[model samples]
Target: MMNHPVSPNAPTASRAIGPTEFRAAMGQFASGLTVVASLDASGNPVGLACQSFSSLSLDPQLVLVCIGKGSTSWPRIARTGRFSVSILAADQQEVCAALGSRGPDKFQTIPWIATAHGTVRIDGALAAIDCRIHDIYEAGDHLVVIGKVLDLATRQDGDPLLFFRSAFAKGLAA
Candidate 1:
């Protein structure tokens, strides 16, 4: 992991990323959009829109998502001990941004319901995986959350939302 800040003394160096280089580099790797959701101890729902979700292993039914260190949703989900991974459909951009915002009211704007484990399960997503936090490790400026899937649900037909070059895209045709 490299720790090169865009500027050493600048307070907002994080915003000064080399966009062209960053986009070009990340564009080479593709990912599906996912909304990582959970309920706080008081049953308040919190979630984040993530493009960094991945399948780590099938044998153990493991999955992982990267959440930034500054994210408000991460801590709440961590406290709850469980979460749900909602694979967004290609048309759910509004839901994505709503959950991706800062502070409270994130759940008020999105449509979801309680999962078997009491975590919030997003409605109309392509799939939803109920998970218990297996491990959370520090990875550069983000936290890599590893989860063991407890329950899984999927729809028969739906196109996934793809994230590439810092924007949303439709999944490729078969």
Candidate 2:
């Protein structure tokens, strides 16, 4: 094969991006806040606060959540092969903080319910989606988990919680 020089300006060209800069840039894109929860092998509830979640497909009823590789909760949840995604309401900042923290008993202070589908769903959320793990892909420092939605319910009527610029967004203007 003949060697060819690649242009530095090429979109796919390797380049260094500062972690802080990348994070900040990503923060510019607002994302809905959610909690991904499931029952452990011991029948205990466990979960994590997440913003990296989205709907992937309609016909297949698929959803996706990007979980950090370092997340201890994901492994535990993964073992069960099922989980629930609770989309937070705009007033649920405390719920997000509780799950985002490092400790056991996150559910001790937060309100949650056991779904008939064998997943843990947060109470008072805007919506809850129960799913079975469809597939998992290893990406750079994160695992992209694709879930096949088994069932879903709208728990409350309210504005969705949002994250932007590394913090929870204030209420939207009416």
lDDT of each: 0.87, 0.93
Q: Per-prediction TM-score, please? A: 0.84, 0.91
Which residue ranges in model 2 land beyond 4 Å of their true spot?
Answer: 1-12
lDDT of 1 by residue, 119-169 (tens): 888899999999999999999889999999999999999888788777777
Clashing pairs in 2: none
Across 49-123, the per-residue lDDT of candidate 2 in tens digits comes to 999999999998999999999998999999999999999998889999999987878888889999988899999
lDDT of 2: 0.93
**Model 1 compared with the native: what TM-score?**
0.84
Q: Which residues of candidate 1, in runs, are more than 4 Å off?
A: 1-20
Sequence-dependent TM-score of model 2: 0.91
Candidate 2 global Cα RMSD: 3.8
